[model samples]
Target chain A: MKKFVQVEDVGMRFDTKKGPFVALRDVDLAIEKGEFIALIGHSGCGKSTLLNLIAGLTVPTDGVLICDGREIAGPGPEREVVFQNHSLLPWLTCFENVYLAVERVFGAKEGKPKLKLRTQEALALVGLTHAEQKYPHEISGGMKQRVGIARALSMQPKVLLMDEPFGALDALTRARLQDELMKICDATGATVVMVTHDVDEAVLLSDRIVMMTNGPAATIGEILKVELPRPRNRLELAHDPRYIDYRAAVLSFLYEKQAHHEKQAA
Target chain B: MSAITFEKALEAGAAAAVAEPAVVAVARSEPAASAASTASVASSAVPVARDGGAPSPKPESRAGEWLRAAARATLPPAIGLAVMIGIWYLATLSAGGSLPGPVQTWEAAVKLFADPFYSNGPNDQGIGWNVLSSLQRVGIGFGIAALIGIPLGFLLGRFATLSSMVNPIISLLRPVSPLAWLPIGLLVFKKADPAATWTIFICSIWPMIMNTAQGVTRVPSDYMNVARVLNLSEWKIFTKILFPAVLPYMLTGIRLSIGTAWLVIVAAEMLTGGVGIGFWVWDEWNNLKVEHIIIAIFVIGIVGLLLEQMLIAIAKRFSYE
Candidate 1:
C-alpha cells in the first residue's frame, strides 16, 4: 500500500535553558491512507511530539515529512488536530466553534448556508446538535471534547490528528466518544494519527499501534498490527480472545520492556 | 433561575442514573441537557451551571430565598456606609470645625444639584456642566489612549523583539505620576484644557498598552495551536482567536486606564482651572466652602465606582468561564 504520510528520520529538539533537549529522535513512520494509527508510550515518551510533527505544529530538526505527496510545510486545515484540551474558543458557541473550522475549510468553495449546514451536520455527527448555541464554559467536559472533535471533523481534513483526545474525559464519556469516533472514521474514511496512553483504547481503535520507548530521546519501539475487524464493539471485544491478545501485547510492551525505566526511576 | 434549578436536578439525577444503567442515563441526560440549554439561552444565564449542576432547592421558597439572598448581598455594604458616615460625623466633631459634617455637605449638595446645569459664565458653571466637562475630557483622552495603546499592545505581545525594545521605556515612564506630565503637556499645547486631556491620554495609555500586551502574550498555547492547525489567516486569527481571548485582559486594562484617567483628570483640572468638577471643587475651596468640596469628593467617588462597575459588567460579559 502507498504511504499517505511518510516521516523519514524525523527528529525534534528543543533548546532548553540547560541544554538541547531531544524529545524525538530518528522517528520513522509511514501511515497508509484511511488507516487509524495510535502512538502509545509512557509519560515523557514524546508520542504527542511526533503527532505535532505530523500535524506540522512543530518542525523536525532533521528529516522530511511528506503528506499527500507534498512536503509538510506548516500547520494547515488539511490536517485538522483535535487538541487534548478541546481548545474551543470559550467565547464561541458550539455551532460557532465548529463553524469556524468549517468556514475556513469549506467557505471558499461553498455558500454561507452550505457552510452552516456542514457545521450543523458535524455537530450532529458528534451527537451534539442540541448544544449548538452553548458556549464551551456552559457545556460538560465530554461535550466540549466532542465539540473539539466536531470542529476538526467539520474541516473535513485529509488527516485527523488527535492528541490524547479522550484522556481528560471520564471512562464512560471516553467509551462513548471512542464509539462515535469509530463511526465517524467509518463514515468519512479519515486517515487518523491519534496519541493514546490507554492500552485498551489503542487496541480497540487503531489499525496499528506504534509504541514508543521512553525519552530523553524517544523513538518508536515496535509497531503492532490490530487484526480485529472493524465495526468493532468495545463490549464484544472485552470478551474476544483476539482482542485480549492485542491488548496484552500492548500492555506487555509498555509494562514489561518499558519497566526498565520504571525501576531506574524507583 | 427555575430552569437552572431544573437542570441541576436533572444532572444530579443523571449522574446517579449513569452509575446504574447506561441506557437509562443516556435517555435521561439527553432531554435534561436540551431543556437546560433552552432555559439558559432564554434566561441569558443559568446560575447553577456552576457547582457541578447540583440539585436545586425546593421551589416554593424561591421568592423568600431571593429576598434572603438580596438582603445578604446588600446588608454589609449598607452597614459599612453607615459606619463610615458615623465616623465622618465623629471625626468632624473632633476636628474643631475645619471639616463640615455630613448633614452640612448633604444640604449643600441638595442646593447645588437643584440647578446643576446653570451657567453664570464658564468659570462659574453648575455642578452638572463641571461633571459633564470632566467626563468629556476623560472620554476623549481615554478613547485616544485605547486607539493607540491596544494596537501597540498587540504588537508588543506578538513580537518579542518589539516587547524587548519598549519594555525599558514603559518601565521607566509607567511609574511616574500622571500629573507630572501636565508640565510637558502645558508646555507643548500652551493651554490648560488640552494639557489636562494630554495628561489623561498619557496616563490612560500606559495601562491599556501594558494590559493588552500582557493579555496578548498570555494567550493560551492551546488557542494558538487551534489557529495553527486551522491554518487560519492572520486576520482571521486576530478576529477569531486573538481578540476574544484577550478581551478580558483588555477590559481589565480599560478599567485600570479609566481609573487612572479619572484620577488624573481631577488633579489636572485643579491645576488647569477648567469648567469641571475638579475645578469646581478648587473654586469652592477658594471660596472656603468646605461642604461643597466634600460634596465634590462624594461625587467623584460615586462616579468612579459607577465607572468601575460598568467596566466590570462588560468584562463579565466577555469572560467565558
Candidate 2:
C-alpha cells in the first residue's frame, strides 16, 4: 500500500551571503496514517527544515514531497503547522485564533454555528475550554502552545506538523503536554510529524523516531520503531527496558555516532 | 511595654518619611507626641493601656498619608509655575516695565477669555475664534493627509519596488521646512485658509507615511508564516495578521502626524494671514499688546499638550499587550 506522506530524496538549500547553504539533502521518509513520528537531532540539524518542507511552508530546493496522494505545491490548509513559538495572534482571543483556521477550512460548507462549534470542540480537545475568551498574552506559555495545537487541529489537516511545539515550555509542563499529546493522538488518530530535540519526548510520543545527522547537509541517519504498547505511562516507561532501549538508541545515534563537534567548538 | 509602642511609632514615622517627602513633618511630630505619651505611661507597665490611643492615631495617620501624597503630586508643578512667574516679573523689572509681567499677562488673559468667541470682523475675531479656526484648518489638512498617506504607506510597505522608488523622494523632501510649502500652497490654492491647510497637509504626511511603512516592515515574520501556512487570502492576511500587527505603529504614525500638523498650522497661519492663534499673535504684536501675545503662547502650548495627550490615550487603547 502507498504511504500516507512521502519525502523523496528531498534537499533544501538557502542562498546566504556566503553561498548556497545546504540545510538538508537526500532526506527520504514515509509516514503511514495515524502514525506519530518525531524528527530528532541537535540544533542546526535541519529537522525544522524537513518539517517546513512537509508543511509546504518552503519547497525543497530539489526533489518532491507528496502528502495524501498529491504533490505539495505550496502551504495549504491540509498541512497544518504548529510553530515552535506558539504563533497565536496576540490580538485574537484563543477562540478566535482557532476559529480563523476552522473558518478557512470548513466555512464554505458549514454555517457559522457549525464553525463555532468546531472551534469550541478543538479548544476542548486541548482542554482550553476555560480560556476561550482570553488573549494569548493573558495566558501562560503552555496554554498559548495548547491554543496553537488547537488551531492546527481545528483544521483537521491530513498531517499535523509540529516544530518543537512544547520546546519553549517548562519541564513539568512539557511532560504534561507530551502525555496529553499522546492521548490526543490516540483519540484522534492523527498523522503527526513533530520536530523535537528532546530524547524522552520522542521515545514517549512517537511510533518512529527519525534521528537526523547534523548539518551542513543533514539527512536521516537512523529510524527507530518504538514498539511500546498504547496507554503508555511515563512512570511505567521510566523502568520499561524496551522504552529505555528505544531512548538509548536515539541517544546513541544523536550523541555517539552523529555528535556535533563543530558546534561544541563554537 | 509602652516602650515597644513608642518604638513602633518611631519606626512607622521613619518609614513614612522615607516613602513620602510631604509626610516628613507629620512623621516628625508623631515621634514627639509618642515620646510624651511614653513618658506619661512609664509608671504603668501595661501595653494594652496605650492600644486605644494607638488605634486613634493610626486612623489619623492613614488620612494624613493620602493627603500628603496628594500634596506631593501637586506641589512641584505649582512651585515650578511660581518660579517661572517670578522670573518673568524679574525680567520685566530688568526691561524697565517695557515687557509685560505675569500679572499684566494674567489680567489680559482674563479679559480675553470673558467674551472669547466675539468676532468684530474676519481678521479681528476673539482669541477663542482664532484658536478654533487654526484647529479647524489643521483638522482638514490632517484628515486629508491621513486619508492619503496611510494607504500609501501600506502599499509602500507591502511592496519592495514601490518602497525603493518612493523612499528616495521622501528622504529628500522630509527634511525641507514646512514653511517652504506655504508659498507653494499659496500659489496653488490662491487663498490663505486653504493654503495654510495645504502646508499642514504637506508637513503631516511624511511622518505618517514613514512610520506606517516602518511599522508594516517590522510586523513579525512569525505572524506572516502563520498567515502563509493557513493559506489565507490576501484580504484575510491584511485584516487578521497585518492590520492588528501594524495598528500600534499606525497609531504612532498618526500621533506624530498630528503633532507635526499642529506645529505647522501655527506657522502656516501666521504667514498666510488668517484668523488663527498664530495670526492673532502677530496682530497683537502689531497692536503692541505683548500681554495678549504671551497669553497666545500659553494657549498654543496647552492646546498642543492636550492634542498629544489625546492621541497617547488612543494609542494606549489600541496596544495589544
Candidate 3:
C-alpha cells in the first residue's frame, strides 16, 4: 500500500512549570492511502498531539511529518480535521458551515462557481438536507458531528482527521454514528486518522489500530492490522472472530500497561 | 390534620396526584390555608388532578401569575422612585431659592428645547449645538479607538507569548485616569478640541482593546481546532470564526469604551473650555445658572442612555442564538 500520511520520528514537548513534559516521543507511523487508521490509548497518551502534528496544527519538537510525499508545514485543504467537539461555528447554519469550507477551498480559487452545489452534495452525504438551515445549537450532538464530517468532506481532503468525534455522544447514539462514519468512509475513499477510546469502535471502523504508551514521553506501542472485511456492520463486526481477537488483544495491552503503571507508582 | 400531619398529607397528596386516576380525598383533616395551598400545589404537581377535584390554578392563571410575578419583581423600584421624587419635592419645598423641583427641571428642559437651536450672536449657542458637539467628539474618539483596538486585540489574542508579555504594560497604563492623560494630550496636540478628543480616545480605547483581546483569546479552542482540521486559511479563521466569536465581547467593550469616552470628553471639555455638553454644563455652573446646569445634566444622561441602547441593539443583532 502506498504511504499517504507519514510521521517520521516526530517528537513534541511542552515547557511546564514543573519541568519539560514530553507529549510525544519518537513517534513514527505511515498510513496507507485510503486506509482507516485508529490511534487509541489512555487520555494524555499524546494521541491528540500526534493527530495535531499530522494536521500540521503544531510543529514537532524534532523530526518531520510528510503528507503525499511533501513536507507538512501547516494546515491545508488536503488534510481536513473533524474535532472531537464537532466545532461547528455556532453562528452558522449547517449548510453555511459546510459551504464556508467549500467556499474557502474552491470558491476563492479561480473559475469555481460550482462550489455551492458541491457543498449541498456534501451536506446531503451526511444526511443533513432537511437541517441545512439549522444552527449548530439547534441541532442534536450526533447531528453536529455529522455537520463536522460534512464540512471536512466538503473540502475533498486527501486525509480526514477525526479527534474522538463520537466520544461525547451517548452509547447508542455513538454506535449509530460510528456505523454511519464507516459507510461514509467507504464512499469517500479518503484516508482517515481517527483518535478514539472505544476498542470496538476502532476495530469496527479501522483497517489498523495504532496503540500508544501512556505519556510523559509517549510512543507507539503497537500497530495491529484489523483483517475485517469492508462495508462493516457494527452488529456483525462485533460477532466476527477477528473482531473479538483484536478487542481481546487491545484490552490486554491496556490492562498490562495499567499494571505496569501501578508498579511504577509503588 | 395537625401541622406535621398536614405537611405529610401534602407530600402524600403530591405522590397520589401523579399516580391516582380519580379524586384524591384531601384528608379534609388539614387547615383551610393548608388546603388552599395544597390545592394550588396540586394544580402544579398533578398536571391533571385525578379526580379533577381542585380547580386547576385558574385557566387565565399563568397570565395572572406571570403578571403578579412581574409586579412583585418591579414594584419595589417603582415605589422607590416615587418615594425619592416625593422626598425631593419636600426638600425643595422646605428650602426655596431658585432650587428647582422636578417640575422646574422639566420646564427648564422644555424651555431649552423650545428654542431648539439658538445663536443670540457670536459666543452663544443653544444646547442642541452643545449636544451635537459632544456627540461628534464621542463619535470621532470612539471611531479612532475601535479602529485601532480591534486589530491590536486580534494580534494580542492570536499570539500568546506576545499577549503575556504585553499584559503587564497594558495593566500599568490602564488605571491611569483620563484626566492624567488630558494634560499629556493637551501638551502634545497644543489645542483644546483635539486634546480633549484625544483624551476621550485614550480613555475609551482601553476597554475595547482589553475586551477584544479577551474575546479573541476565549474564541473556543474547539473553533480553532476546527480551523486547523478543515485547513482553513488564516484569513478565513479570522473573518469567519474569530471575528464572530469575539463580536459580543468586543461590542460590550465598545459600549463600555464609549461610555468612558463620553465621561472623559465632558471632563476634558470642562478643563479645556469648548463647545460640548461638558462645556455647557461647566459654563452654566460658572454663570451660576443652576436650572441650566440641571437641564444639561438631564440632557447628558438621556444622550448617554440612547448611546448605550444603540450599542446594546447592535450587540443583540450580532449575538449567536
DockQ of each: 0.62, 0.81, 0.55
RMSD (Å) per prediction: 14.5, 9.5, 12.3
Candidate 1's docking class is: medium
Which regions of candidate 3 fall more than 4 Å away from where they truly are? A108-112, A262-266, B1-74, B93-98, B122-124, B155-173, B180-191
Worst window of 10 by summed lDDT in candidate 3 chain A:
A257-266
TM-score of each: 0.87, 0.89, 0.81
Error of 2 at A251 (Å): 1.4
DockQ preference between candidates 2 and 3, better one: 2
User: For residues B1-321, could you state the per-residue lDDT of candidate 3 as single tens digits?
Assistant: 122333344444435544653233222212332444444434543443323434566645654565456555644554444344444444454466567765566667777889868876534788898889889988998899899988888889888998999889989999999889888887899998888888888888899889999998898888877777666678888888999999999999999998888877788888887778888888888888788987787788888899999999999999986
- Among the numbered candidates, top TM-score falls to 2
lDDT, candidate 1, B1-321, per-residue tens: 443344354545445564765445545554554454444443432342323234456543564465456555644554445445544654665577899976677678789999999998877999989999999999999999999999999999999999999999999999999999999999999999999999999999999999999999999999998888888899999999999989999999999999999988999999999799899989999999999999899899999999999999999878888
True contacts kept of 3: 0.85
Single out the weakest 10-residue window by summed lDDT for candidate 1 chain B.
B44-53
Clashing pairs in 2: none
- Candidates 1 and 2 compared: the better one by DockQ is 2
What tens-digit string does per-residue lDDT give for candidate 2 at B46-158?
33334433567575555455545645564455434433444455456457778987667767778999999998889799988998999999999999999999999999999
Q: Flag the better candidate by lDDT, 1 or 3.
A: 1
Question: Which residue ranges in model 2 land beyond 4 Å of their true spot?
Answer: A263-265, B1-61
By TM-score, the candidates rank as 2, 1, 3
Which candidate leads the pack in lDDT? 1
TM-score of chain A of each: 0.98, 0.97, 0.95
The order by descending lDDT is 1, 2, 3
